[model samples]
Target: MAEHGGRDARMRDAEARVVGTVEFVLDVRVEGMVHAQAVRSPYPHAVIRAVRTDDALKVPGVLHVLTGAELEADPSVDPYFGSPRPDQPVVAIGKARYAGDPVAIVIAETTAAAAEAVPLVDVEYSELPYVVDALDAARPGAPVLHEAWPDNNCGSWRLRHGDCDRAMAEADRVYSGTYHSPSASHVPMEPMVCLAQWHGDRLDVQTSAQAPHAVREALERMFGLAEGAVRVRTLNLGGAYGAKTQVKIEPMVACAARAVGRPVRMELARDEMFQTTAKHAATVQLSTGVRHDGTIVARRVSVAYNAGAYALSSPGASGQGLTRANGPYTIPNVSIDCVATYTNTVPTCPFRGAMTSQLAFAYESQLDEIAADLGMDPLALRRKNLLRDGDVYPTGEQMHDLHYDAVLDDLEHAIGWDRPPEAAPPGKARGKGLAIMLKNTLTPSRSQARLRLRADGRVDVHSSSVEMGQGASATVLQLAADHLGISADRLVRGFPDTDVTPYDTTTSSSRTTYAMGLALQRAATDLKAHLRTLAARHWHVDPQDVTVGGGSVARRQEPGADMAWEELLSAADLAELVGEGTFAADFGLLLMDDPHDVHGPVTVHWHQGGAAAEVEVDLETGRIEVLRMHANCYAGRVVSPHRVRQQNQGCAVFGLGPTLFEELLYQDGTVSNPNLSDYMIPSILDVPEVITSSALESDDPRAELHGVGEMALPAVSPAVANAVFAATGIRLTELPLGPESVLRALDERRRNDDQEGTTR
Candidate 1:
C-alpha cells in the first residue's frame, strides 16, 4: 500500500473538475424537459393587486404560467421556509416586499420561449413607502415591513458579562467609533440553478446546493410528499461560500414541474441572482474603556443588520455578531446588542464570514484607536488582552487548546511588525498594521456516514456533505483510506443523495470536515472490526486475537497466518461488509438560552485567526496599494496540505474585495450595480505581491482538526484599515475605503492644520 498521510497527493488541474463530465447537473437531459423563468416585480415595496399570466401562457411553446396565488391556494404547497421564523414565501403572495420578488413562474418547451414570455406577464402593484437603511428601519415612523412586527425589528440578541457601567466609570480613558459595511454579493461562478422532475408520486431534484438533505426536507414539506418521495442530488458546486446553504428556489422549480407534468429547469440570470441572497449590510458601534496600563477594562458593542425584505438567516447572523463582538480579547466587563432589522431590499443570508467580518471591522479598528490613546503599540495591546487557555468567553464558554499566541507570533514575525514600513515612492506613505480574530463554530449539529466494503477490496463512502469546492470529498477520502490502512485509490465517494446518504445538518458554519470526519472515522473503525470478526471465524481463532492491517486480517501470535480481505469475505459468503456511524453534538451542554449564561460550553470549538499587512497610500490620489500581507490560522491538523493552503489564500483574497472595492450599490431600495461591470471584485492586479499564510497544529488529541474556511476573512478588513490609518493619521470607519473618502479626510486634516498654525 502507498503512504497517504502527510503526502501532497491532490487531483491535478486536468482531473479536478467535472465541467465536461456526465456528472454535471446542467448537462443532465430528460425527455420532454421544459425550461422555467421567473416574472419578478419592479417595485421594492408594493401591494400586489393582481397577477395576469394570460399573455405569458399565450406565447408560442409556453406550456403553463403559475402565479403565487395559485400556489398559495393549493394545500400541498408550503408557502414559507426558514429557520427561527419561516417568513420567506416561495413567491410573493399578497405583497411584493423586494424588487426582485417572483410574482409568477413561466414554463415553456424551450429556454428562449420562457425568456420571451417573462416580460409579458403583468403584475399590478401599488407602490408604498419603504426604508433601505438598517438603522433607519429601527427608528420610529419607519415604514413597517411586517404588520406583526410593529417596530420593524426582525430580532435582537444581547450578551452581558459583568458591570459594564461601573467598569466604564472607573476607566481612565474611553474610545468610541461607528463603522459601516455595505452589502456584497456571493458571485459564485454558477448562479442558482435547479432541475426538478416529478415521476409518478416521487420528485427528484438536481441542483447546485450546499446541503442536499436540507433541500430534500424543504421539498418534502412544501409538496406534502412522504419521507422518501423527494430525492435531492447535488453535483459539484462551482462555488458556494455560504450562499447556497439554505433552501432557495427549489420549491418554486418543483412546483412548476408538478404543474406542467414534465421536468423543469430554472437558472437565475446574473442580475436575478443578485436579488436572491446577499451579505447583511451592517452598522456597528463599538466603545472601549481602558486603563493607562493598556488593559482593556470594559467594551460595549451595538450592531444593526439590514436583513432586507425578509428574514432568512438574519436572526442567526445577528446572534453571531453579538457573540463575537469582543473579538479575541479578554475584557472582564463586556456588553453587546445586535439587532436584525426588516427593510425593503433583497433578503440577507450568510456570506463567507457573515456578521463576524463586519463586527471585526468595528471591534478591531477600535483597538487601534485605544492603543493610540494609551501611547501603546497596537500589537503589544493585543498581546496583553489575548485570551489564554483557561479564559472564558463572554457567552460563558471556556477556551481550551487555544493557539492565539502561536498564530500571532508567527504572523508578526512574517510581516516584520517591529521593523519600519518599507520605503515608498515620492507621493506615497507606507505603514504596517495587525489584527486578531476569534469565532466559534455553530454547535448542536449532527452528521452520519455509511461505509460499504466491497468484495473487490474497494470501499464506498456515503454522506450528505457537499463538496462545494472546499475539498471536502478529498479530505474524507484521505481520512478513510488512512484509517483502513489502504491506498487512496481504493476508496470511492458517492454523490450526496438524500434517499441513500445519511442525514447531515446543512454544510455551513465550517463544520463539515470536523463533524463529518468524526463520523467517517467511526464508520471505518466499525468496518475494521467486522473484517476482524469474519477472519477470526474463518481461521477458527478468537476475534480478540485477530488484528486488521494492510488490507489483511492476521492472528497476533502467528505472523504467517493472515487472510486477505477478499478471501475472508468470500469464506463468510457475504457480498460486502456494511458499517454505520453517527455524531450528535452535546446540545444540552453547549447551547445556552441566555446570553449571560457563561458557565456552559458555548460552541463546538473556537476558531482563531491573525493577520498583518503592509500598505502604501498614494498621498495625491488616495489610492492604497497592498505591498505585502501575512495571515496565520490554527487548523489543529491538516488532512491535505495543498487544499488547506489553497483555502487560506482564497479566503485572504476574498477578504481583500470587501476591504477595498466591493459593495452592492443601492438607491431608492433598488440595487444600482447588479452586474460584474458595476460591482467590482478583487482581481490579480489588486492583491499584494508578497502574500503568505500558515496553519498551526494543536497538541490535544480531540483537537486533531479544526475549520479554516472563514477564519482568515474576519481579520483582513481590519488589518488593512489599521494600516491605512497608520499611513495617514485619519480613521476610516466605513468599508470599501475608496479614494474619495481618503482624499476628503486628507483635505479636512490640511484645513485643521492650517487653522492651528494661524492661531499659534
Candidate 2:
C-alpha cells in the first residue's frame, strides 16, 4: 500500500506539470471560433428600456450581437437555470436584477474586436430601488427581486426535533446570540470560461466546471437537444472550490455559437467572476439551553441566508445549514428554521464549506458563550457532549465511526492546549481555542466508470469526475492500478469527455474519491474476472482454478503455467477487454421525504473534523496574528497521506481569509471591492509559522473510505474567533474580523470595563 501510495504522488505531480503547461478553457482553440463578450448591467435593479446593436454589428470584425429579447423569443432556449426552480435567466430579459448581470453577447472575429464592440452596443436602463442585505430584503414590503415571489423569500427550510420552548423553560440557564458571516468570492485562479460549438444537431462545450454531466444535461434541456446530443468536456481546472459546481456561462456561449454559425468562446474577467457568484452571507440567531453541569438540553436556531437576486442553490444551502445547525454535539431537543432570501445582489452559491461553515461559526461560538456563562472550561463542555458511536443525530440519523473525542484529544495535544505558553510581550495577549464540525456527504447520486484493458497490458479508466486540483484523478488511478494487480505507472488517466466516459455526478460534496472510487474498483474487479475466464478457457481449466496476479494469469495446480497478460490476450485473439460498473445510492434508504422532519437520515455519511488555533493579539493596532494552527479529521483510509495533509492545511489557510480579512463590501447594490486589490485572500506571508494536521483512520467497516477535501475548513474560522474571545474576553459575532472591527470591539470593551470600575 505504501509503495502504491508513493507511485500515486509521482503520477499526480506528472499530471500537474503537464496541465500547468497548457492554458485553461479560454485558450482552448477551435477552428472557426469567434470571441464573445457579455455586456453586463451596471444597475443592481433596472428596467431594460432599449438595446440597440446597430453600431456593434457595423464593426469590421463583429459577426453578431445577441440580446436577451432574442433569447426570450426563441422557444429552444430555456434562458433560465437553477435548482428547485429555474429562476436565473441566461441574460437579463425585461429587467436586470443585479449589477454585472449579462444582458447581451457581442461575438467578433477576435477577442479584442469582441471587447471593443461590447462598449459600442447601446443599452438603456431605468434604475429601480434595490436592497442587498438579506435581513432588509426579508422585511415586509421590501423591494422584491422576483415578481413571482411577493415576500422576496426564495425558500425556507426547518428542522424540528423536540419542543424547544418547553426544553428552554425547564433548563437552568439559556444563552442567546446573533452571528453573521459575510458574502465572499471563490476567486479561483482561472475564472469562469466556456467554449461552445454547434455542429448540425449536436452541441459541444468545453468549460471549466466541477460537474460536466450536470452541464451537459442543462445544455440539452436549454437547447432542446437530445440527451446524447450535447457533449461536455473538462480539462484540468486551476481551482473550483465549489463555485463551478453548477452551470455558469455555458448557455450564453452556446447561444452565441449557434447564432454566429461557429464556435464561441467567453471568459469572465476577475471583476465579473466576483460579481457572478459568491458565498451566501448569513445571519444566524442561536439560543441554547444548558444545565449548570455543562450539558446542553435544547437548542433553537434561526438562519437567514442571502440568496441574492436568484435562488440558484440557496434552497439546498439553506437546508444543509438547518440540518447541520446542531454541530457535532449531542442535544436532546433542537429546532432550526433556515430561510433563503432574494436580494438584488450577485446570486449566492456554495463556497468551500457551503453553508456549513456559516452555521459552525454560529453554533461553535455559541458553545463558547455557553461555556463562559456557566464558568466551565470550553473544551471540557465539548468533551462532555461529544457524540459517540450509535448516537442519534437531531435528524434521527444514526452516527457511525464518529471519533470526536479522539480527534479533540489529538487537536488539543497538537496545539499544546494544556501546556502553559511562554509569556507574551507586555502589549500582546496570547490564547488558544478549539472548534468541532460535522458535515454530511451528499448521497443518492449515481456514479459510473468504464475500465478497459489494453493489448499491451496497460489499463485506462474513464469517468466524468473533473480533476479540479483535488487529487481525484490521481486517487482513481491508484485505486484502479491496485485493483488490477498492475503497477500504478501502467495506468493512464482519461480526461472527462461526455461522449466517451460514463456518467458521473458533479465532483463536489467530497464524494468523487469515495463514490467514483467505488465504481472504478468494481469495474476493475469485473475486468479481472473476465481475464481469468479467458485464461481458463485457453488452459482448459475451470475459471476458479485460474489465478490472476502481478499482471499475469496462471493455473493454480500446474507448474510452468504462468502467462503474461499481453500474451494471454493475444492468444485469445482479443484487442482489448472492457468492463463497466456503477454505484448508485438507494434514495429510499438515504434521503428523508421531508428533510425538515426530525427523523431519517438526510445524508449518506457524516464528515467529522476539528481544529485548534493559537493566536496573539496586538492591543495597540488591534491586529490578531495566528501563531500556529492544528487540525485533525477522520479519513477512513489514507489514499495519499501527502495529499490529505495538503488538503487539510490548504483549507485551514483558506479559512484564515474569511475569519480575518475577506468580504465582498457592498454600497447600495454595487460590490465596492470586486477586484483582488481590495478583496483580500491569504497569501504565503499570511500563513502561520507552525501548521500541523493529522488524518485519523477509522476502524468501522462502514467507513472504509471517506472524503477529506472540505473537512477542516468549517472548523478553523470558529476556532480562531473563539481564540480571539479567549484572549480579550470580547465576543465578535460577525465575520472578517477586520482591524477596524477589532479596534471598535476593543474600545467598547474598555468603555464597559471603565464604567464597571467606577460603579464599584
Candidate 3:
C-alpha cells in the first residue's frame, strides 16, 4: 500500500464538498416538505402575556403557528429543553428571557411565506429589569431570569486545594488584577439547520448535529417516545465549533413537524444564528502570593461567566474554568471560584476552547506582570514553576504524560526568544511574547463503532463521529487502512446515523481522534479474528495456526494454504462478515457535594500547548500588526502529523480574531452587530506575515494519541496581549484589544508621564 498515513492524503469527501455536490441538512428535502420561521420577542426580559397567532394563520400558504403554551398544554411533549439541565423552553414559555427569543413558529409552504407571517404573529410583553453583565447579574439584587435560581446564578463551582489563607499571609509579597473577555459568536459557514418528519408516530430527524445519539435521547425523552422511535442522522457539517454540540434547532423542528403533520425544515438566518448561541463573556479576578525569589506560592482566582438567559453548557464550562484557572505552573495553595451567572442576551455555549481561553488570558498575562515586578525574564520565571511529570494536581491526582517543556522549547526556537528585538519602523515599536496553557478532554464518555467486510473485499467502518470539516472521516479512513492492511480507497465510511452507526458522546472537546480511533482499531482486530476463523475452517487448521495480515490469510505451516481476502470469503460462501467494538473512558465522579472539594481524574488526559508571537505596534495609529506567530501542541503518537500542524495553525489564527478585533457588540442587552458586515473576523489582510505550527511527540512506546484541536487556542490571546505590552509599556486587561482601547491607554500614559516630568 502507498505509504500508510501519508501527509498528502486528502479527505475522502473533499472533492464532493468543493464541487457543492455534498448534501447538507439545508439541502435535504422530502415529499410535501414545508419551511418554518420563528416569531421572536423584541424585549430582553419580559413576561409573555399572550401570543396572538390568529393574524399569522390567516396569511396565504401559512399552515400552522405553534406556540410554547400550546405544547405545554398538550401534555404529550415537554416544552422545556436544554443540555445538562431542562431550563430552556422550545419557545417563549411564560416569559421571554432575551431579545430574539422564539415565541412561536410559523410553518408555511415556503420560507418567504413563513417569514412574511412571522411579523403578523403579535406578542404582548411586560418588560422587566435586566442585567447584561455577569458580575452585575451575580450581585445581591439583580433581575433574576429564573425563579429557581434566585441569585441569578446558573451554575457555580469552587476548588480549594491547600490552605490558601496561610500561604497568602506567609508570602513575601502579593499582587492582584482583574481581567475581562467579551462574548463572541461562532459564525460557522453553514448556519444552524434541522429537518424533522414523523412517520406514523415514529420521529425522524435530519440535522446538522454534532451529537446524534444525544439528540435522539433528548427527543425520545421530550416526546415520551420509545427508544427506537426517534431517529437522528447527520450529513457533513460545514463547521461546528461547539455551537452545534447537542441540539440547536432539532427539538423545535421536531415539535413543528409533529404539530403540522408534515416534514418541517428550519434554517436559521445569519442574524438568527448569532442569537442561537454564543461564547461566554467572563470577568476574572486574580490574586497571587509570591516570595521575593519569584516563586509563586498561592493564587486565588474568581471567575464569573455570563450565561445569557438560559443554562446551555454553562454549568460544565464553568466547572472547567474552575479547574483550569490555575496556570500550568505548580502552585501549592490555590483557591478558585467559578460561577455562571444569568444575563439578558444570547445563551452561551462552549466555543472552540470552552472556558480555557478566558482563564488562560487572565492567568498568563498576570504571570508576565508578576515577572516584571520581580525584575526577571518571563521565560525564566515560567521555567522555574513549570509542572513536571508526577506533579500533584489541585484535583488530588498525579499528572503524567506532560510535554509542556517540549512545546515551549519548540515555540521559543521558532520565535527566536533569546534574540534581541528587531528594529521597528519610525512609527512602530516591536517586541516578542509567549504563553503556555493546559486543557482537559471530556471525561467518562464512550464511543462505539462497527466494521464490515463485504463479499467484494472492501471494508466499511460505521461510526457516529460527525465530520464537521475537522478531518474525522479522513482520520478514521487512514487509521483503518493502516490497521487492516488495506488501501484507503478500499474503505467505505458511514455518516453519523442513529439507526446504523453506534453511539458517540459528542464531537466537541477534540476527543474523536483518540476515542473513535480506538473503537475502530478494536473493531478491525475483531474482524481479523473472524477472518482467521473462516480461513482456519476452510483449510482444516487450528484458528491460532491461521495468520491474517496484508489483506490475506494463510495457514502458518503450509506454503500453499494461503488465500486472499476475496478468495477466502468466496470459499466460505459468505456475503459479508461484521465485528463490533467500544471504548469508554474511566468513569470518575465529575462533581462532588462539598463546594470546596472536587473529584480526582477529571480528564482522560491533559492537552498541553504554547504560543509565541512577534508583534509591531503602530504608535501613530495605535494599531497592532502581528509580524509572525509560532504555535505548537503535544500530540502523543500522532496519527497524522500534517493534520495536527494544520489544526494548530488554524486554531492560532482563529484565536487572533477574538484577541484583537472580534467581539459581539451589544447595545442594551441586545446583539447589535449580528451580521458579517458589522462583525469582523480575520480576513486575508489581517493574517500575520509568517505563521507556523508544529506538533511535539513523545518517544515512550506507551504513549497514546492526544487531541490537538483546541490546545493551541487558549495560548493565542495571552501571547498577543503580552507581545503588545512588551512593545509599549501599557497593560490591557480586556479582550479584543482594538485600536481605540490602545489609543486611549496611550493617551492616559502620556498625561501621567507629563505630570511626573513637571514634578522633576
Candidate 4:
C-alpha cells in the first residue's frame, strides 16, 4: 500500500491495471480426458534391472504404464542452446542418475487412479556408487556418474590475460580464501504443470515455462516432428525467478500423451518440486594481490561447480567461479580457471541472478579487505580501479560505454554515504558497506514485440516475454501507449501463444525494460509512420506535413486540422495497421565470423550499478538484519521508474537470502536440505525497511539501452559479508552467515585473543 517510485501518481508502482483480462476458469465437461502421474527413483544411483507393469495395468481405471526403455513414442530432446552438453531424455534411458530421476510414467482415468497405479508398477534397482560433491567427484577413483567421462567433470570456462606472476611479485600484500556457495530453489507459487496433446501431425502443449520457445524447440526435437507440428503456449505464470527458465515437465507430458494416445497432464507436488528443480551449489577458490595504494595488482581464481547428475545448467556462464575470475573493477594481471564437474545431484539450474550473485560475494568481499588494509576509503578504492568506457575484459570482450566510477559516485550521494559505523552498535555490531557490479541483457538472445493499430485506433501489442510477476508486459504497454499518442489503457495486449508470438530471449539480465523496450519503440514508430501515409492521402498533403500525437495525425502548423485516429483509419479503408520488431545488444565490435570456427569473440556489453547496505548485527544472537538499502544503476534509461524499483527490490531480497541464510546440505551422495524448510528464504518481514533502489540513465550509441537485471545482486551479499567482517574482524568465507555461523566466528575470535593474552 506504501507508495512506489515516482511514476503516474494515479497508478501504484506503475502497475498496469488489467480490468477484463481475467477469465474465470470454468471446469469443463469433456467427452474424454485422462489424468497421469510419474514414478521416480528413491535412490541416488541405481540400475534398471526390470520393470513389471502388469500390476499397474490391473488397477481400476489404470490405462497403461511406461518406462524409459518403452518411451519410444518421442525421439531425444535437445539440450538448451543446442550445445553438445548432454540432453535430458524424456525419461531415464539406461541408469537412474540421481534421486528423483524419472524412470517411468503412467496414465489413468482419474487422479486417484494414477496415484494408486504408481506403486503398483514395480522397478528393480541395482545400486551403484555415487559422487555427490563436485570437488570430490573430480578426485581419482571417485565414483563416476557417467562412465564415458573417466574423471567426472561436465564443462570448463577458462580465461587468461596479462602477466599473472609479474603482478603477484609486485604486490605488497596477497590474500587468499575459500568460499562455499549453496544452492536454492525457484519455488514458483504454482509448482509446475504441463499438458501435452498430439493428434497426428499437430501438437498442442500448454505449460508454465518462463522460456516458451525453448520448450517448443525441445518438444519438437523430442517427438521427432517438423517444427510446425509442435505448438507451445504458455499460460499465466504464478512466478518464475529464473527457475522456470528451463523446461521441466513439458517433455514428460508430451511423451506420456504420445504413449497413451491421449492428452496427458503432469504436475509435481510441492515436495517433489524441491529436488527436481533448484539452484546448484558451487565451491570457489579466490585469491588476490594488492599494492600499498589499494590497487589490485594480481588475481587468480578457480571454481568447482556441482553440475548435479547431468549438465543441465552447468556451462558456468555467470557464476561464483567466474565471479572470482573477473568483475566490475580493473585487475591488470589476472588468471582464472573454472571447472564444472559432474556429481550425483539434481542438475543445477539458473535461479534469479544465477552465478553472478555467488561471485559478487567473493570479489566484493575481498575488495573491502584490500581497501581497509591500505587505510583507504572503500568507495574511493572502487572509484580508482572502476572500469571506464571502452575497457576490454580478459575474455576478449570489449566493454562499451562503461561508467562504473560514475555509478559508485552517484550512490554515494543518493544514499548520503558518509561511512556509517562498522563496529558493533555500542554493545551490538552494526555496519554499512557498498558494492558495485554490471551485467548484460546479451544478444542473439532476441525479444520480439508486435504492434497493430486496432479498429478503435489504439495499438495492440504482442510478445512472448512472460510477466514472471516482474511487470514486463505492463512496462511494454506503457511504452506503446506513450509512443502511439494514446492513453495507456488503449493498448491491446495479446494473449501468450508461441505459434502467434515472436521469439523472446526470456526475461532475465534486466533486459525487458531496455532491450525489449527499444524494440517496442521501433515497432510502434513503424506503425505510426505507416499510418501517416494514410492520413496524408486523406488530407491531400505530403506525408511529411502530417504530425503524429494523441493517436491522431494533423497538419504540422495547423492545430485544429489534426485528423482523429478513427477517421484516418476509415479514410484509409482499413480497420487497423500492423508492424513488428526485435532487438538485442549490438555486438559489431565484439564479434567476427570465422568460417572455421562455429563462433567468434563477442565482446561484452556495458552495465554499471552501485548499492550500499546498512546492517544491524545483534551480538547476543548474531542475527544480522539489513536495515537500509540504496543503489544507483546507469542502465542507459529508466523505461519506467516504478518497474525499475520492483526490479531493484527483487535483486536485493534475492541477494540478501544467500548472504544471511540459505544452504544446500549434502551427506555422502544424497542432498540433506533439498526442501525449503531447511534452506531458508527471506520472508516479507525479513526484508529490510531502508531498502532504496533507483537508476541513472543517459543516451549512448554503444547499446540501445544498458541492461541491469542481475548486476545489482552480485555485490549485495559481499557488501553485507564485508560489513560483518569490518565490525567483528571475523572473515567468514562460507555463505548464509546464519546465526550459528556468526556465533562460531565470534567465538573463534574470542579464543584466539584469550590464547594470546595467556601466552603474553
Candidate 5:
C-alpha cells in the first residue's frame, strides 16, 4: 500500500475520483403537506410593527400564517460570541436587526400560492440610521446598531510577547501601512436549505451543514430538550465553504414544521444567503520597525474586524488574525491589539481564507516596502527572518515540526525566484513575492470516526464531517485503506447523520484531514488488530506474532498459509465488525497553559505553512495577474496526495479572490453589492498556472495533523500585491485592485516621478 503509486498515484487519486454532486428528488404524496414562503425587509435596519396575514389566508391553498409572535421558541446564545448586544432574538420579534431578517413565516398547500400570498402579507416598519463600518461604529455617539453595547465594540483582545517597544526604538527604519480587507459572501453554488420533521417530543432535521452535531446541539439548547432527543442529518450538502458551520434557519424550519404538526423545508435566496453569512472585512493598521539589514526588528499590528451585525465568529477570527499578523518572520519582538467590532451590515464567519489572508496582505506588502527602502532583495530579506521549527508565537504557542524554512527553500527553485524575471514592455516591470502562513488544525478541534467491515469484505467508514468540496471523505478512505492494508476501492466513506455517525467538530480549520484522518487511522488499526486476532485464533499462535500484509494476515512461521481479509470477515460473528475512533483537538505539549485559550482542554499550539507567488503587471493599465504559485505546508502526513493538493489549490484560488478581487461594499449599514454580479471573484481566466503545490511535512508527535485549507490563501494575495509593487512603484492599500484604483495609483506615481525628474 505504501509503494503502490509512490509520488504520482498517492497525490493525484483524490482529485481524479471526486465524489459527484448531490441529487435530490422531492415526492409530493403527503395527504396535506403545505408549502411556505417569507416576505423579508427591503431596508437594512427597521422596526416591524405588525405582520398581517388575513389577506394571504383568503387564498384557496393557504393553510395558515406564522409570525414571530405565534412561535413558541426560546433564543440561544454562543459562548465564543458575546451576549447579543440589544439582546438579539432568534426571530425578529419586534424589530428586524439587519436586512433580510425574517419577521414572519407563511404556509400554504402550494408553493406557487405561497409565493403569491407573500405579496399579500402586509408589514410596516420604521427605519433607523445604521453604521456598517467597524471604525465608524467605534466612533463616539455613532448610531447604535445594538443599543445594549453603547460603543458598538463587540469584543477586544491583546497579545504582548517579547520586547516590542525596545525592538522598535533600536531599529534603523520604520514601515507603516494601513491595509484594508473587505467583506464578501460565501456564495456557494447551493443556497442554505433545511428540512425538519417535528413529531411531539422529537425533532428530525435534514440540511446542508458542515457540522450536523452542532446543529443538533443548537436545537437542544433552543427547544430545551435532551441532546438525544434532537437529530440532524445531511443526505447531501451542495457546498459549505465555512458558511454552514452553525445553525442558521434550522430552528425556524423546525418550529414552522412543529406549528402545523408536519414537515417543512426552507432554502435561502442568493441575496439573503449573501447578507446572512459573508466574511466580514477589517481595517488593519500595521507598523513594522526594521533594522538596517532588513532583519525585522519588531512588528506592531492593530487589527479591527468588522463584526457586521452579530457576534458569529468575528472575535475568534481576530485572535487568529493577531497570531498571523506578522507573517512567518522570526521577529523577536511583536505586539498586536485585535478587536472585533459590531456593525449593522451582516454577521461574519470564517470563509475559505478567513483572517489570515487579510493579515497577510498587510504584513507581506510592508516587508516589500521595507526591503525596497533598504535596497535589499525582497526574497533574500524574507530568508533573513524566516521562522524555523520551535518558533514561539505571541500567545506563547510553540510551533513544532515547523518546516516554513524548507518550504521557502523549495519555492526558490520551483518558481524561478533565483534570478530576476524581465519586466513588461516599456512601462511595466515584474517582481516576485513570497509569504509564509499557518493555521490551527485542532484548536478546540476534534473528529471521531467509526469503521465497520461487512460480511462481504467491504469497509464502511462513518464520520459526521461533511465533505464541503474539499475531498475530506476521500482522504479518510485513502488513509484507512493504507492503514488497514486494503485497497481504496474496498473502502466506502459516509458522513453526517447524528443518529448514526460519530462526533466530529466543524469541518472548517482544515481540521478534517488531521482530526478525521486520526479517527480513521485509529479505526483502521483496531480493525487490523481484530484481523490479527482472527488469524491468531485459527493459526494457534499469539496475536502479537501475527502480521498483516497485502490485505492478508500471516503467521511468521508459515507466511504462505495466511488468511485473506475476505476469509476473516466471513467468520466474524456480527453482520459487520465495527471499529470506533475519537480524537480531541490536539496541540502538542509546549503551550498547554495558554492564557488566551478560553475553551476547555488545552495543549501546545502549532501551525505550519509556506507559499510563494510571482505575477505580471500591465503597467499601462495597472492590471496585475499571478503567473504561477508554489506552496508547501507541514500539515502532518499526506493521507491522499491527490486530495491534499486539490485542497491547497482550492485554498490558493479562494484566497486570491479577496486579495486581488472580491469586496462587500456598504453605505450607511446597507450592503451595496448584495449580489454576485457586482462582487467579483476569480474565475478560470483569473487563476494562475499554480505550478507547484509542494508540501513540507512536519512530524509533530503531539498534533495528529495540521491546518491546510485557509493557510494557503492568506499569503498569495500579499505575494501578488508585493509582486505588483515590484513591477510598479505604486503600493496599493485597498483591495479588488480594480481598474479605477490601479489607474489612479498610476496617475499618482506618474505625477510624483515627474516632480522628482526620475525616469525608468
Candidate 6:
C-alpha cells in the first residue's frame, strides 16, 4: 500500500484548534496598536456635501479622523481598487454608492473610544434614487451606479458552439424555466480583521485573508510603493469560504494608520461584516431541447448576476456560471450569455461553491421537469446524456478522467435508488431524487513551494496556501512526507507569510491541493537530489551511484552502506539544504481543433460530482425534512479519505442553509438580517438523519489528484428540490424553499387541478 495516498489521516491542526491553541488574526496583537472604526452612510446613493469632525475629535482617546474628502485630496494615495474595474473606493469619495458605505474612519487608542466617536463623526448627504435588483438595474431608465457603465452592467460574457437556434427549432420538444437564488452571507465564525503598521518606507500588514499575495499587490499599487516594500501575513483563519478572498478594509485601516502614525487594527462587527460582502443573487433562464427518447440536443442559458456595488469577482464568477449552467450532459449545440449588473447593495464576492450552486439548482431541477414531461425515469434520462471521457466540452476542451457514472452508482447504492418508495407517516409524503454537476477549478494560476532540509533530519515546507479549516496544511504535509519517505512528525508546516512563504494565487476555486501539492512534490524531488549529491561528496562516491530514499542516503553499489540524513549532513559540514519548485497551469486548448478560437480553457480540470436525497414533505404545511443525503465525487486520487468525506459532509450542511432557510433580507437597500440573531444558518439539529459521502478513485495509472473542496456542493439544493417535486407533483423554481412559498405553490397546484377537473 502507498504510504499516505489512501490513508485516512487526521488533520494536522485538529488538536490545536480543539484545544484553543490555534491563532487566528483576531488573536494577533501588535505593540502600540490603536483601534479604528468606520462611519457608514445611511443612504444607498448619496453625494457628500460637508464634513463634521470637530465633535468627533473632542472625544477622549480619539487620535485621528480620516474622511473621504481628505482621502480624495491626498495626492499620494489612490482611493480606488477592484478587479475587472477600479470603481470601488477605499472610502466614499465624492459620492456614496450604497448604504453602509464608509464615509470616514476614526482611529483611537482603544476600541471603545473608536466606537464612541463613530456616531459623532456623521457626514451630510443628498440622497439619490437607487435600484437594488439586478434585472431592474440593467434597464436603461434605472438608477445607474457607475458612470462608465451607463447601463449599470459590470461585465458580460458569451459562449456559443454549433447552432443552438437550429437545434432548438428542429428538436422534438422544448422546455424553458427561470430559477432564482437570493443573496446570502458566508458568516464565517471570525469577522474580518486587519492590522497595518509602517516602518520607514516599508509597510507590514497582518490580516485574515485567503489571498495574502494579492492583498500585498493591491496595497503596493494603492500606495504607489515599491513592489516588495509591503508585506502581508495571513495566519490560520477561523473560516473564510470566499468572504476573505480579496481586499477588504485593509486600505481603510492602512490609511487610518498613516493618519495616526501608529499601528491600527480593525475588527469588523457582525453587522459590518454583512455590509462587507455577500454571495451574488442570480437569475438563471434555461431552455433545453430534448427528444422523446430523453436525449438532450440543444441548450441555451441566460444568467444575470447581481454584482452589488463593485465588479470585484463578477467577470470570472459570471463567466464560469454560464459555463457550468450547461450541466453535466452532452448537448450538440449550446449557447450561453451571462452578465453581471451593478446594484445598490453590499458588494458580492465568491461563496462556498463560487458560481455553481445557483446554476446547478436551475439546470438540474429542469432536467427532472423534462424527464417527467417525456414520461421517463429521471435517472434514466440523466444516464443517457451524461458526459464521459474523450468527449469535447462546450468550452472546446477535450474531457478526460470523467467518473460521473461511478459517482452516480455510489449515490444509487447509498440511497437505495432501486428500492420501492416507502410509505410516509400520517401527513407526510416521501420521495427520492438525484442530481449531478460539473465544476471547474481556477486555471492559468501558479503555486511555488520551498523545502528545507534541517541538520536534525527534519524537513520544513514553506507554502502560502491558507488553512481556513479546509485541511490544506495537513494535505501539504502528507504529500511531502510521502514523497520524502518520512513520517509526518519529521516535517514542519509553514503558514502563509508573504515575507517568508512563496507565492500562491488564492485559496479558493479548490485548486490548492492540485496546484500547491504538485509544487511540494517537485520540491521534495529537488531536495532528494541535493541530498544524494551531498552524500556522494562525503563518501567519495559518484553522485549518480548514491540514492536518497526512506529518509536516508545509501551507496547503490553497497547495499549495507546507508547513512542517516543527520549523520550525512554532519559529515559533509553542512547545516541545511534548500530546494525550490514552482508549478504554473498556463497552457490551454490542448486538444482543440479549431484554430480561430481565442478563448483558452477556463479550468485546469472538471470536478464531476452528484448527490442523491431522500426527503419527506408534509402535505398539509408544505414542510420538508431531508431524511438522508448521499454525495459522491470523482476525486481522481485520494490523499486522505477522512478529510475528503468530512469536506463533503460540511458542504451538504453549508448547502442546506441556502436551500431552505438562508437569505439576506434587504429593507430599503439596507440588509435587515445582518446579525446572527436575525440571519439563520444551519446548526447541529439541521443535519440530515443519515448523511453519507464518498470519493471515487480512478483505476488508471495516469489519474491525477483533484481538489474536493467544492465538488459536492453544487448538487445539494437541486437534489432536495427535485425530491420535493417528486413527492408533491408541484415544481418550485425559487431558492430557500420556505414553507410559505411551498404552501403557496401547493395551493396554486390544487386550484389548477380543480379547474382541469371542471373542464373534464
Question: What clash pairs does model 4 have?
Answer: 319-355, 397-603, 424-428, 424-429, 425-428, 510-709, 554-562, 590-603
Clashes of each: 1, 0, 0, 8, 3, 0
True-structure RMSD, every candidate = 2.5, 2.2, 2.2, 4.0, 4.1, 2.3
Off by over 4 Å in 5: 1-33, 72-88, 531-541, 548-554, 557-561, 564-572, 586-607, 689-692, 698-707, 754-760
Query: How high is the CA lDDT of each candidate model?
Result: 0.84, 0.86, 0.88, 0.71, 0.71, 0.87
Sum up the clashes in candidate 5. 3
lDDT of 1 by residue, 593-690 (tens): 65334345657788888778999999899998888888767888777767777777887889999999899988887888999999988899987999
lDDT of 2 by residue, 238-299 (tens): 89888898788888899999998998899889998998899999999999998889899899
Residue 168 miss distance in model 2 (angstroms): 0.7
Residue pairs with clashing backbones, model 3:
none
RMSD of 1: 2.5
Put down candidate 3 lDDT per residue, 225-249, tens digits, no spaces.
Answer: 9897999999989898899988778
**In candidate 1, how many Å is residue 647 off?**
1.1
What residue runs in model 1 are displaced by over 4 Å at the alpha carbon? 1-5, 12-23, 588-591, 594-599, 699-702
Worst 10 residues of 5 by lDDT: 77-86
Error of 2 at 379 (Å): 1.1
